[model samples]
Target: MPFTDHERAYLDAQHIGRLATTGPRGPQTRPVGFKLNTDGTVDIGGIRLSSTRKYRNIRERPDTEVSFIVDDLEPDGPGAIAPGWGRGVEIRGRAETLTDTDPPLAPGAFSREVIRIHPRRIISWNLDPAAPELRGRTA
Candidate 1:
């Protein structure tokens, strides 16, 4: 599914997410600190000297699945029923490692290594009970 404007905006608002990759062993997932660029790409930073399974997987195959929990809705008032946590957004796309030669990393974030995700689909759902209006939507 294609990404909607709102969904894109939501993804851009987030600063961190989990990245999933397939390796020779099996599927692997890890927490990634990220930054969303205006061009609609996600940049993940980490040390380049280390050799992690995720990095290795990307080296083998660039295709990956990334997801992040953006928001969790909760009750705000007394006597008001509490709403469950809101659903998160998941993105499936091809990932590529960025080198220092690429558009240099942003300030404060270590720029030794970065992975960019080019999404092909976006999936989201609402986890709030009071908000039955929340339903899974694909884009």
Candidate 2:
């Protein structure tokens, strides 16, 4: 798998993530609901997703490179100075715009339209205490 056990678990538990895509004007990012597919691909979808810029970007650029991140602040532990600890995983790879053929990531919450991400590289931080910070590797 591209993701470690901790990274996969974190992604499975999280409902929202940020997807970055390059468009005509510039780079754009938006909060998105995603599903970790059985094949280790990330699928992002939302209401009216087909009309969104991210979708257009993928459709327009056959080789659309994208980045996705799911993260949250970790509660402070004993002896912690402040409550600013963070943990998350980032997936960077190519994206494809899929329409009508795939099921929604969240039934009723998202449409059949989705942006499927094939991970080329994975970056994770603080997911496992034994793991190093900002650890990254090719998928």
Judged by TM-score, which candidate is best?
2
132: Cα error in model 2, Å: 4.0
Q: Number of clashing pairs, model 2? A: 0
> 1-139, model 2: which lDDT tens digit per residue?
7888888888999999999999999999999988898789998889889899888988999786899999888778863322587788999999998888464476776777888999999999878767647899999
RMSD (Cα, Å) of candidate 2? Answer: 2.5
User: Could you tally the backbone clashes for each prediction?
Assistant: 2, 0
Residue 70 lDDT in candidate 1: 47
> lDDT (0-100) at residue 94 of candidate 2?
93
TM-score of candidate 2 relative to the true fold = 0.90
The lowest-lDDT stretch of 10 consecutive residues in candidate 1 is 126-135
